[model samples]
Target chain A: MNTIDHHWQRFTLRQKLSRYAVYLVLVLAFFQSIQSVEVIPEFLLDAPEQMGDMFSRMWPIDFAYYPVAVHDAMIETLNIATLGTLITLIFAIPLALMNASNIVNSAWCHWISRFFLVSSRSVNSLVWALLFVSIFGPGVIAGVLAIAFRSIGFVGKLLGEAIEEVNMGSIEALKATGASWMSILLKGYWPQVLPAFFSIVLFRWDINVRESAVLGLVGAGGIGVVLDDSMNLFQWDRVAMSLLAIFIIVILAEIVVVNIRKRLI
Target chain B: MAGIKSVQNRENPFKHNWFISAIWLLVVCYVLYTFNAMDLSWGRINEGFGHASNLLGRMIPPNFSRWSLLLSGLIESLEIAVISSICGIFISLFLGLFAARNMMPSWVSTPVRALIALCRTFHPVIIAILFVKSVGFGALAGILTLIVASIGFIAKLFAEAIEEISLKQVEAIRATGAGFASIILFSVMPQVFARFIGFSTYQLDSNLRNSTMVGIVGAGGLGGTLFSAFQRFDYDFVAAILIVIIALIMFGEFLSNIVRRIFR
Candidate 1:
């Protein structure tokens, strides 16, 4: 009697070898990173206790402190976020059009716009705020400019994608009529991209609100100024209050974005 | 008169909705009001430009004499990214399943969703600040902050991925008399694992960028050095550090692309 042989394997030999190699490399990297980390053993040991103590102090948050310093700063943060988003559209629109291959029709123009967008995104808002604060001598304007510069990449990238995805038939129809470039853009791309453009703008505005809340930490200006002052003064209660305000505002901004996007899109 | 009005309407193909127009009007007014309130006059902006150019002149020819110091900070940021991404991805696997509406009961998923939301609500820098206050400052705080950030983001994405998977696979597995856990292992996981890898790689990239700066809050990395250089008016050194950070992020982007290709 001859017995039938059966064989089953989830992966081939070469696949298994590659996966094992990847795993080996990952393990080596993990241990290497662990060795380089400089953790204070004592601090690590008492982390839970330290966390408890900090939480205890944070309790009984000073709600009374909100109106005194946080109120005006919160308003200024909203203004910075709003103004920054509005200003971003000014620079973002042209750059987005330039970056859209179908719209710009020049590889050189597209690359220039791409470089600017990438550099803008690579630099964090806080870093931009640091640079702006030095130039503006520390104020809301620094915060606003920081937000605008950081947002240009995000808004431009999304808007460019929307432009690229527009119905080509409409554009071709406009071109066939011997329409001017400006009119073709207005008649063809504008309607197709408007909804997406508004949605992207609103989404960015929401993010800008959260970012602006912390810009003051770098002395650019916002509720973060109050947060920094409170932290410095060891006023944990006031810090707690500031955190609460930021939390509420972020949630509210999300709701606003969702509602506006619903109607616009 | 009606014929003339109809022709005018035809001339303007786009109808002007008063509701949208009203909203636009309100936005314009609000912008003008806020502009006035910020007190950003032309003179101030002009003066700022003058200062900016002067500062720009100082940052030219970035100083890299302290290459060792810069290298150490860059390495620390990398380590923090790696460690946090690993731990965060590990934890999110469980949290994500618990939070998936289709996989778990509402009672379980609801609280998990809320917890994820809380983690996501604050910026990692803010979390790093709190961690610094508790952990007494170091890479540990930065790692913890990024872990929370990772879990917040990836868990939510994981849950959404799971929800979108075909339930027919689950039913097919269950029909074999397989238990709930086995069903999840055999069916649910295979479907979402690819997307989870994508999210993990993206999170790693994000964590790397964030780790470079969490040091600003004394969490530990290049950001502390950058902040100190800025305050010290060491413009050239700051420029050098910014260059290194951009290079690091670009390298991370390259690494992630390779990883995604391998998995795909």
Candidate 2:
């Protein structure tokens, strides 16, 4: 038994050492971060009590402010999402076409479009909102533009993939018929990708609805502005109301998108 | 005759459905009305172009004068992301198992699903605010907030992945009279392990992006530095921070790609 164990240990020595080394590094990093952040065990012990107190304050939401403050903001949020999705579709369609390897034969165009998609997607919508707020000044326009810019990558990437996955048989048939490039694209590729494109756009719209709600935190303008204001003023009841509204709207958007996608597919 | 009759019965492909058209019309009207109410006029838009150009001019020559401040914040953000992702992934593994309807009873899965849904309802920024208020501001709050966000996201995906796994292997393991833990270890995990790795890497990427933003609410990270710089109208500094953030995110994207490749 001792000889067998020794042989096994010798055989797996390198693999075991490398695995342990990786885990050791991760553990060290975790502890270092905890120390740097000064996370006190005593504070963690008291966290539940503090959270309970906060929840107690938030009970019985001030629904009275709903019509006055939240209603308009909710509408603005919806508009931002809808318009943003519309704008995203407008830009994403052409960009997706360019990015689709099957459609765009030019390697440079595909790479350029892919770069745009990746860079756009890499930055969070909040950052985009911040940039737009600086330029457009705090309003729904900034919110709309932020949502649009952030969603372009998501919409474009999905649509491009869908286009790439299109049936080549139909495309070749169109080509054999000596169809014009415009006709082949419109009659061949478009039909195949339309369902997926619509579904992707609707799904993005659902996400944008949730995202646009928070863009107002950076003064991009939406329901999040109301949320930020309530929090700053320590109006827990009003904050609760806004949160409730956001939750309901997000769930509703999800349901709507799911239904639409079901129909489209 | 049947093919000809089928062709004759087909509707004109170019004609739009009435129901869809009506929906489109209503949407258009709502958009127009919303635009009017928001006062998004062309004049306002034109004014924004000038502001954009002016801001762009100041943003040139990105400032790295506060290199130490930037470096510390970036490191802290990275730490928060990695720590939260590890913790979140660990917790989510169990939560996902409990929430998998195929593996668990409805009574168990229902409550777990509801908990996950509640976790997911609010944005991370809101959760970070709540954590900051309760726990006091710092990386701790940021970490807690992101852990919640990660669980909310990946747990659901993980549950779905588990549900979609083939039960044959599980049944075979059970037929051998293996204990629950052993059966799960031998059967359940292997099938979903690859997808779990994919989800974990994706969560890590998302957490990295979010860690930067949570600092805006004073939960601790580069966002705080960036926010203060913006408030001080330090556009050059802001530009530098933005550049660093973009680079960090791209690096994360690249890392996730490599991780996925390895798993594949």
Candidate 3:
């Protein structure tokens, strides 16, 4: 079914060499521009010390604000993540299937799906959060939407890849039984790839949890809102307390996700 | 071959399935619809672009008046990046190894693996903001943010590298009287060290890029200046700051390549 030709190897070598040359040219162009550019503002000598003093002054955090508001805000951050992940999951599953190379059974479908996934992933989530904040008027909803949108890109890409790795033999067998494409996918492909799909989803959920925490800085609500306010107010101690809560929540969430993942695998 | 042909025949088997095409078309349309609903109009985009261009124009001949300020901020950012990378690489080395299922017990590996996941859960900016808030704005917060980010990224890569290694050599080492530590040093390290180096260098490059951003959240570095520039609508200064950040990232990328080559 396959032919090993010497010419093919030569062609691949030529391709690799061209790629290397392009990389070299790009690097050279970048450096050339950098060298010519004027050094602006000039580097500060005592900036580090100033930064250090700022940090040292804020030492020994104030923990008295622990009763209800801070705790509730922390919970809201977690909820934002959970809701965002859930929404992305609903959107991603169908999108992933459409993108799945083997499942889609169409070259145009595959290429277009690939284009969408790649473009979505090219930008970082923070950029999306900023854009959403401007449009949605800075609230939990904006943060949730940003997280959900970003997670869709992440989950869709992984799930599509997972679908491609499924044992296609069963799919063929199902098709041979005169089953429809939908049935073959449901009965054959879904069960095999379900484990990996769920794992990726849960893993992304953990990531979204962390992301939602910071969405508030851009006005996408959560603990970040409080953190931002404290910073603006120059309340270093309050800032310290907020950070402690974030660290604790992240660590706790990490433990829970790890336990769940361990049990699943 | 005949059975395969029959299976293929039953499905639409068109080079482009109509259903998938419709789905994509619908998605694109939905995106467009959302844009319209959100009022992300051409006028707003045009106005933003106009402001951006004017800012870029002003950024030319960057103000060398604040040379000392710029220089010190650059130095602190570089330090924060380097220190965090060192801390991150150190933690990643041990955590990655311990988390590798093939290299360690389920009980031992699971916790370490979980820690890595937790480390990776947050964006560096969010984490930096947290640290700035918690630790009180400065290089320390920036460093902590980057260190956590590096650990998250490198540990995952390291664990995967370890998992992918040949078990035969590990087993051979185990058969010998070498202790677990020695076995890891000889067998596991040899196979994964190069990948670990690659990951470390990449993490360093990433940390450098991120260090500039942490300052935006008041964690330290040039970002604070940049953010203030943005707030003041000092487009020229903002442009100057952005150019410097870009240059820093490019330099980091170059340095990482050199490090990778040296290790290789």
Candidate 4:
């Protein structure tokens, strides 16, 4: 009896070469990043101590301060998120209609809507808040606008994708009936996209809540204002309270969104 | 005959869902309440539009005179994003395996799931602020904050990916009498490795977007420069910074898309 040699390898020579190249690039990138990211040794060494110190100060949470400042700020934060989501729906629906390739066949429309949506998404809410704060002078209006602007991109993009994914048969049926464009949109696409639309809005609203909570840091008005104020004052206890409030609101918002989305989709 | 007539008769094909109506009513009520509670006057909105146009006009031509300063801030953000993503992906690779219900017992997975959820609950900006307080600010704080975020997101997705894998394949690997680690390496890893790559690239993209802004809280990056630009009313420079950030995020998205295709 004779046995022939057997060999197995995960990749061909070309694949191996490419994989090696990728690894080499990653290694170089990592080293370049580490060198550029100057780490102060003292600060690095004291991080644990600093954490411990902060935690110590945060202990004995200022429950009393919650009612005084955090409560109203928290409520305002909720309002901002809700109002922002509602406003987003207004702008987003039209933009989404234009963006969807299935809905608007014009190449020009797609480009214009895509540009608007991408620009909206590219700028972070904080940056938007800063811009709006300058224009609106830092208040609920700025906060609401910032949230709405940022969300238009997200809500519009997802809604557009949902619109694109609808069943063509139903749409064709509506068209065959000699329905007008508006009627077809209302009778055909609307029902199909409604579930997706609800879920996306709820999801975006959930995110907007967390986002608005921090817009106050930029003076857009929300819990972040209370948080920034307490932090600046070195009122560690009050900061702790505000943080707690923010945490609870976030969890509650998550719960509500999950419940609603489950029932919806 | 009456029963047949009544059965065929319907006002609307769609049943009126009370749940949806309630949600709509609630939304309307909330918006109305918010308007009443907040002092968002129509006059203020009109005046705001004037200031907005003025601000937009000033931002034109996007001053690149301070190109060198802009370049440095952009580089720092890139470095923060790369470092944090690398560290975060590395951590999540292990954390995800532990959190997967199919791979681990209930006791092990439950606590890890809770930890991931806790990490996910807060916004990265809030986390960045806390890290700034603790780590005394710098790129270190940003890196830490983003690492937490990346872990929270990627690990959950990874665990979910793991949970959905075919257990039949795993049982087959076991039938061959392979060791635990070998079984994972041969059977489980093959199924999930592609998805893991996808998640890592997505995390990198997210971290890049987030790293650009963490500097707003002084954790480190373009944020501080951008904030200062705003303070000095350097609208042109601010516009330039924003342009750079948008370009950076879009580039990250493109890069991730390529990476995903490669892995796929």
TM-score for each model: 0.94, 0.92, 0.61, 0.95
Q: How would you order the candidates by lDDT, starting with the best? A: 4, 1, 2, 3
Q: Which ten residues in a row have the lowest lDDT in candidate 3 chain B?
A: B5-14
Instruction: Return the clash pairs for model 1, or none.
Output: none
Mind giving the per-residue lDDT tens digits that candidate 3 earns over B48-161?
556545645666767656667676677777777777777788888988888989878999999998888777766788667655545565777787788899988999999999
Best by TM-score: 4
lDDT of 3: 0.72
- How would you encode candidate 1's per-residue C-alpha lDDT over A21-112 as one tens digit per residue? 76687778888999989988898888899888878888999999988999999999999999999999999999999999888899999989
List the candidate numbers ranked by DockQ, top first.
4, 1, 2, 3
lDDT by residue (B1-264, candidate 1, tens digit) is 555544453556555668867978998999889879988888999999999998989888899999998998888888998899999998999999999999999999999999999999998889999999888889999999999999999999999999999999999999999998899899999899879989999998889888888988999988888899999999999999999988888888898887777666
TM-score of chain A of 3: 0.82
DockQ of each: 0.64, 0.53, 0.09, 0.71
Give per-residue CA lDDT, model 4, range A221-264, as digits (tens): 98999999989999988988988998999999999999988877
**Over the stretch A1-265, how does candidate 2's per-residue lDDT look in tens digits?**
5776654342256655654665576689778876776566776788999999889999989999999899999988999999999878778889999998888899899889988898788778888888898898889999999999999999999999999999999899989989999989988898788798788888899889989999999998889999999988999999999999999999999998889788778
Which of the numbered candidates is closest to the native, going by highest lDDT? 4
Query: Candidate 3 chain B TM?
Result: 0.89
The residue pairs found clashing in candidate 4 are: none
- Residue-level lDDT of model 3, residues A42-105, one tens digit each, is 2234445655765675676768765545777787688678767776877788879989877678
Q: Lowest-lDDT window of 10 residues in candidate 3 chain A?
A: A36-45
> Which is better, 2 or 4, measured by TM-score?
4
Least well predicted 10-residue stretch by lDDT in candidate 4 chain A: A1-10
